[model samples]
Target: MRADAVSRAVLEQLRELHCLEPEQTVCCALSGGADSVCLLRCLLELRPVLGITITAVHVNHHLRGAESERDRTFCQQLCAGLGVRLAVYDVNPAARAAQEHCSEELAARECRYAAFAQVQADWIATAHTASDNLETAVHRLVRGASLHGLTAIPPKNGRFLRPLLRVTRRQVEQYLESLGQTYVTDSTNLTDAYTRNRIRHQVIPALEQLNPSVERTVSYTLRSLRREDDFLHQQAQAAYAKCHTGKNTLSGLETLHEALQFRCIAMLLEEAGISCEAPLLERLAALARQGGRWNLSGAVYAVGKSGTLTIETVQLPEPLPEAIPLQMGENRLFSGFVLHARLETVSPAENVANIHKKFANACLDYDKIKGEIFLRPRQSGDRMQLSGRGFTSALKKLIQANLPPERRRTAHVLADADGVIFAEGVGCAARVCPDGETRRLLVLEILGKC
Candidate 1:
């Protein structure tokens, strides 16, 4: 194909996908390699026609010694020749790898994206081609990954866009050579230390030998799997919406087919801000079938009568006596409690009535509560009057209303210098309401162990 035709095909794919917008700034992540160089060339040629500005961002991972420095210098010259803005970031990938205790590949990816996000650009573009997708699919399949993993790298993920996903590596190299374009190649990519490299260098070639169109077939399979995966996700979402009652029940999940049940559980765990892994899912499934309870990572699972499943996270313990005071809009971990505070102003149009009823913990009218607020464990003989009822109740009775025994013991209560006003994870008091006419707005927060 002609260089112009190749450029047009790539640009058309991006435009159809709505990856680029008119007059919006785009950052191209240039590594001075063949793929990235070709991508940069194509975007530069399309810039004037599309009326968009392009900036080149090079993240020097400082891993390739002199070759890495050369890559940055080449990118700078390329951007200058094209009259595009160039930004460079130098990061110590080794130190980051050690700190994160992650593989060098993952650390480098994180560092590169962190640098890209720091640049002031609407979108970040990368050169991930069809070959990368094929290799990823094969690798994930070998590792026994689910459909989500087999789907591999998406064409568009978050602010990152891959305009070259539909193009093959051979096509990219040919296009560059036809234009007499010279680009660098990272030597690490040739090494078989990484699973992806092993697939690319060995496994894929063997598969292609069996069938010449294996790469294309794999890509098509991934696309179909992506569609199926998306449909399953939708079904799981519908199931979750139907079954979820307040935040604890697994009713709708148990009703689903086994595949849908696993998907629903994984989705719910993610929604609860808990990360799920293969082992956790297996343990959860085992717990569901064994008619017993098990704890995995951040969640607890219990199987009740008639195959009913209950999933709950352990409540965080109370803050320490020496726990630091939280400031507005700050999140801090004290003892076992996650203390988050935010300040907001109440407007005349905004409804501020009965805000205390929403939270089991105290939502003191910021103006009515005097002195600085403190968060600590419940003290003996701590007492407060429940908001709806006229009679006073002890903290012990208030906690028993609808809370598990283990959670109640660790629950923190909010208080002033006088006494406990609001028991965390329980109920608020009537005396804490803001006087409607005089009170403006105060900071209301939930202090809990996450």
Candidate 2:
């Protein structure tokens, strides 16, 4: 390719990044290294044609001591010479690592991205080349990565864009040479101490010997995997919608294909902001296939029973201490639920079975109530008459028979001086239930519990 063609190849990759709006400023993450220097130069050249403004930001991670400071100084000089505005952040990665309880590399990456986030730009550009992506894929694969990890670095991740993702490191060096530009090299990259460095120096070269164009081959494979991953992701989304029983719970996951089943569980975990590896996901699938429970990280637990999986946070709700007065046609808010009561004329089409079938809503015979109704947590000695029993049953017995133990404790009930008029998640008291001769009804609705 020609010199301009080489630069344009990188620029084309940048344009391919998602969410690249026109006429927005591009913040270049310049590290004074070959890949980043080439990225900054290409973005600067393309700025006028693409109708975008350019600014460069550099972070001094303070891990290499004076060498890191030298890199920062070089970035400042380069930006000044090119007339591009620059922002420099001085951060101590060791101190950050100590505070965050993470490795130095992770702390450095976090600090660098934090510095990028501080810049006011529409898109933050990074210099991750195809070579870096190949190395990352190989390293992650060795460490037991899934299909998503095999796809490697994304072109656009949130506000950060890897414009040189399709460009090789050799192309970056060639582009810089054509522009008569020089870049500082990080000595740490030459060391084999880090896994990524080991992969770049040892693993990738060994694979390249098997196939001379290994990087290109990996890049092509990654693109294909990305497309396939996207299709599977969409299928998983559709399957998840079907499996959804409620928030934090899914059903019929066991019936789904293993591919969709794993993705569905992963989606749920991600939605909860919880992290789980392939092993945990596989265990969860097994739980769905059979029946079991697991306590997961982030104070969450998963229970699989009867082909249904429910993931719940560890924080249980605290029931209200006192009874709440319920006024007709008014909404009452309790600790765990909201109650709304309104009087309605019983329609001829509405029957006892229909009213009792709606869990959140219940139609009670209005005339049978002798006092004001109150919404309260189930108290000991509470009793409710089953619709056909002709006698009141202990509320605890009713709840235990119908609801799980956890739900039974937190469940609320509607009551008056007469007795317990209705039990939550159970059914309305038999005495207060609407019958064929009932003219008026108290439509009570209890919502938003567990």
Candidate 3:
């Protein structure tokens, strides 16, 4: 019942969160620090009363020399003594940073969260105290953020929980002191080399001079902001549903409030696997209203037309298929389609309307062929005169009209030595159309992957 008791704080948080059910499993992320060690112990103390199982996980980010190993050892020993099952994972943050082309801090965070996801538990808890929230607020504010960013960490994000969010760092250390427990101190935390450490040691203490309970004050303010963010997010979700008229399209976004419009646009971008900044969101909003196109990162394009917006991700052209000789059997092309050619002799007096009707675009006049034929992808400047069409059009145009942006790169082109005989979805060219003069017919069909 003491104010400094972390177990009471965790219990109160669980009661309010409703994230746990009877006999559910809870896993604590044991970082071997005072905060993490204190959290693991408090959950152990509360396990019986809460009717839940307790487990611990340790992620050894091999950043520091021997200190990292020391932390891991401490965690193993601590979990063993507490009689709690533990899972340990080792990750190379430096290697991950180099591979991902990002900072070590971000790489380390990714490594830690990925490790947390592997732990088998109904809820995964981390020891982020009120003090950490204050530091996070300062960090996000310095980096330029909106209401959501300023709100910093939430108490519960999906299966992850921050039970110590309402508790202070001072209480964490005091609770450990109450039990005479010792924890490993990471040397990196004492220095200001990292941005988070700089904010924690410098900016936080500076603000503490004005308000001794600045951490508590920031936590209270952030709690209120989080509630507001949740409300806006719910409203935005409803508006997004109403605006979504079809797949990859959103309509009537211009009719909503500017805030709702932005949120709706955000939902659209998010569904397309795009993470945007404010400027990008603003540009998309403008596109949604005025009708235009914005080139997004990674060959993606956001297009707006007739009050509807959509995203198109341009695909890298598949390797041009090696010209394979078209024969009287099936030829499987690397372009993910099979070209089957069946040869048949036809007399001028033969009634072939049924054959042409059944295989309209798949038949070719074999006598019109000048030389051998091959199956391949469309070439630049390639032109095809489709059957029944009077004029020839660029193969590129036909592909653009018939296939999606992603599939156009892999569109098949069937041709003879003279010119293109047939195109995928465009049918046999006018030069190869079967008629009464046709002496032989080459029935061609393109089948999809088996």
Please tell me which predicted candidate would have the highest TM-score against the true structure: 2
Which pairs of residues clash in candidate 1, taking residues 3 or more apart in a chain or in different chains? 316-449
Where in model 3 is the C-alpha error above 4 Å? Answer: 1-4, 297-300, 304-308, 312-450
Stretches of candidate 2 above 4 Å error?
Answer: 297-300, 312-450
Clashing pairs in 3: none
Candidate 1, residue 367: Cα displacement in angstroms equals 73
lDDT of 1 by residue, 342-419 (tens): 554555554545543443244556666667777666677988886678877788877777568876765657777666
Evaluation by TM-score, superior candidate among 2 and 3 = 2
**TM-score to true structure, per model:** 0.66, 0.68, 0.66
- Ranking, lDDT, top scorer first: 3, 2, 1
Candidate lDDT (C-alpha), each: 0.74, 0.84, 0.86
Worst 10 residues of 3 by lDDT: 315-324
Error of 3 at 128 (Å): 0.9
Q: Please give the lDDT score at residue 1 for candidate 2.
A: 48
Better of 2 and 3 by lDDT: 3
What digit string (tens of lDDT, one per residue) describes model 3 on residues 10-58? 8998788987887899999999999999999889888888899999999
